[model samples]
Target chain A: MHHRLDALLPLAGAILFVMLWWLLALSGVIDPVLMPAPQDAAVALWKGFADGTLTHDFWQTVWRTVLSFVIATAIGVPLGIALGSSSRVYAAVEFVIDFFRSTPASALFPMFLVIFGVGEKTKIAVAAFGAALVILFNVAYGVMNAKKTRQAAAHVMGAGRLRIMVDVTLWESLPQTFVGMRSGISLALVIVIVAEMFIGSTDGLGQRVINAQMVFDMPLMYAAIFAAGALGYGLNLLFLVIERRFVHWGGK
Target chain B: MTSHSPGSPHITIRGLTKAFAGVPLYDGFNLDFARGRITSIFGPNGCGKSTLINMIAGLMPMDGGQVLFDGKTLRETVIGYVFQNYRDALFPWKRAIDNIAYPLVRAGMDRAAIDARVDELVTSFDIGFDLKRYPYELSGGQQQLVSIMRALAPRPEVLFLDEPFSALDYEMTLSMRDKLQEVFHATGVTMILVSHDLEEAVYLADHVLMLTRRPTRIAEVIDFGAPRPRTSATLSEPGFVRAKAHALDVFQREVRRAP
Candidate 1:
């Protein structure tokens, strides 16, 4: 009972914040145009679905994030695993990796626009660049954290470098890689939306938000924000499902 | 194949030496393991017992000296290791059968031969209940049992066990020891076991090799003349008690005398 109550405490604060927002809007302390009422936000969500505007934007954001995630994983996982498995490679390249990781991925958005134009390609490139650092660091961590005993056992059992990776290193590093991908997905969503707002031609959830704000459509803008949150949450759920299936024997 | 007489040694170590960080663990260590017999190595903590076993198994580099099998080096023989801690030894992501088949697979054996060996082992070891279960699902003792079977499955000429039964309960340890003896007898494979427990050494080994503390060298070799099919009854034999007492005395004396 206490465990459950402790879990509910965070939700209680969220509920209180919503109640305050409703009261502020009703009392005119906050203008309805600036912050739509709860009922108004609901009506906007229903209308978005009824008219198919939300579906189009959501799918656009989904494809961009998916494409970025795939590209980042393809390039980052192997490179990270290779470097992290060797102390020499890690020492040589760690400084450069750290430099890129600390620098803001969005700071290069203008350069991306110049190189690829204001198209889906530009948005995806930005998202991939934004997500790659997380994937790389996580894969490195996963490889480095492989148990010494397992590695020794594999070598003594006559496993060469390739066989070691195939039989031992890959599966051992999977759980951590999945966890890193989970965090990377969150960053992917944010980057996808931000990229669209900054350098997009048409049709993305972020573009929808920017478009609504351009015309002073308060309810529509709020609807887009809620949809972004839902998309991020749904992606997180999908990652969890994948992790549970592949890493069923983890933690034991 | 080099043949030994009924009482000749199968494994020989001469002037074995190893050092870590400029500190010597073994300086001119020497011992011999008789053919077709279980030799228990007894020593106190940090006496390089595991290090010695590793050198014998070719798992670690040696600073000096030679380890011979059947009067020839490991170049002419096969060696297997049953690691001390099963929790960290077995591959957690692999099923029991897969783990047993790993070495054979790496050896480039035929698929049919590998499958047959895997089936034979899983059945003989009675790990069928967990043929598909990952290492994480098995208990520590069960994992150790599986590791032992896996090590033996490759049919190596000499098997080195480093505290293999230390993690098991008393009952499980006794039962597993019996099983191991059966396997050893059936295959006629030479066995070397490094252990800390005097009772265990007395129970399983035909000869117990005792070592001194760090910079360890062979202190003495105690021979247990107890017959095969060792049991709790063997523990009460006169030679068994004498061997255990002599081995313990050497260990306690050396551990105190060193530092």
Candidate 2:
């Protein structure tokens, strides 16, 4: 009975959150124009999908997010492994990696725009750049921290350096690599959405939300915000599922 | 294959030197491991019992040393090592069977031959648990058994074990000890075990190697030639009791001799 109740507890919290939002909307303490009723947002969501505008915007954002993530992963995993293999090499460039990682992707938008000239290339490049650094740091960490005993076991078994890396080090780094990939994908999505809002994007949830607010289409703006929220939650969940399936021995 | 009879030196260590931050742990250390006999290394705390074995096994780098297995370098001779932490020793990602097969794979043996060798090890171990299960799925004792299997997979001439049972409970330790003895008698593989527990050290060893504190030297090398498959009854035997007491007296003396 306790287990069943625990499962339903999350549902209860969601319902309570919706109730609080509805109550605040009815109270009218804030202007109705800024805060639409919950039903108005839901109705706008349905109508936007039915009219196919939201569907187009949703796919556009997904395409950009996935493209950048793929690019980031391609560059990150190998580079991370190469850097992490030797302690001396990683130490030399550690500060440079840390500095770029700490700086916000948004702050570098104008520089990217200067390079790529204010188009889709610029947005994707910026998102991929932010995501790649996150992935590189995590993958390198995983490789560097690969268990010493495990490596020694392989070496004692007559394995050469190349074989040890492929057989043991690669497998050892997987759990951490997955951690990096998940965070990288999430960061890519956030940057993609923010880029769409300011980089002159014509279609995407970010562009739709901003355009709705400019014309004071309150219900549409709320709907776009909710869509973005759902997308973020869904992507995180997807990566988590993938991580469990592949890295089954991860935390063990 | 060299010599199954005990007392023949299978490995020679000469002038082994190692230090931690300039406080010498071993200097000009020399030792011999008898062919086809169990040797348990015992010493005072921080005396480098594990360190000595690791250096001989080529797991740790020695500042200066020469180690030879039948006059062959580490790369030329096949060796197996069972680490104290079985959880860290066994590859969790691989199934129990695959973990046992890993050494064979590393040796570049064909797939068919690898399967045959792994099957032989499985039967010898009398394993009833599913070999397809991952390491984490098994009990602690079972995991350690898998580690032992993997070590023996390459059919190494000399097997090095670093406190193999320290993590296990008393009950598990007893059965693992029996299994090790069974394997030793059946195959006559040279076994080197490093243990802190004196009784455990003497129980499984044909020779117990006692060492002094750092800048370590051999305190004594006592040989207990009691017969194979020693059981709980062996613990109370006169020879076993005398050996244990002798080892304890030497151990206590060395502990007090510390600066």
Best by TM-score: 2
* Tens digits of lDDT, candidate 1, B1-259: 6567644778888998899999989888777788878888888788888888888877788999998887777756766788888878788777877888888888889999999988887776655366677887887778888888778778887788999998889988898888887777777788889887889987888888887778787788888878778888888888788888888888889888936
Could you give me the TM-score of model 2 versus the true structure? 0.98
State the lDDT of candidate 1 residue by residue for A36-128, as single tens digits: 887788789889978998888989899989999998888779887988799889889898988987778789888988999878888888778
Q: Give the 10-residue window scoring lowest on summed lDDT in candidate 1 chain B.
A: B122-131
**Candidate 2 residue lDDT tens string, B82-135:** 999988878999999999999998788999999999989988989879999999
Model 2, A219-246: lDDT tens digits are 9998998898899899999999999999
Per-prediction TM-score: 0.91, 0.98
Counted clashes in each candidate structure = 0, 0
Per-residue lDDT, model 2, residue B159, is 93
DockQ of each: 0.61, 0.84
Query: After aligning candidate 1 to the native by TM-score, how far in Å is the CA of B234 from where it should be?
Result: 3.2
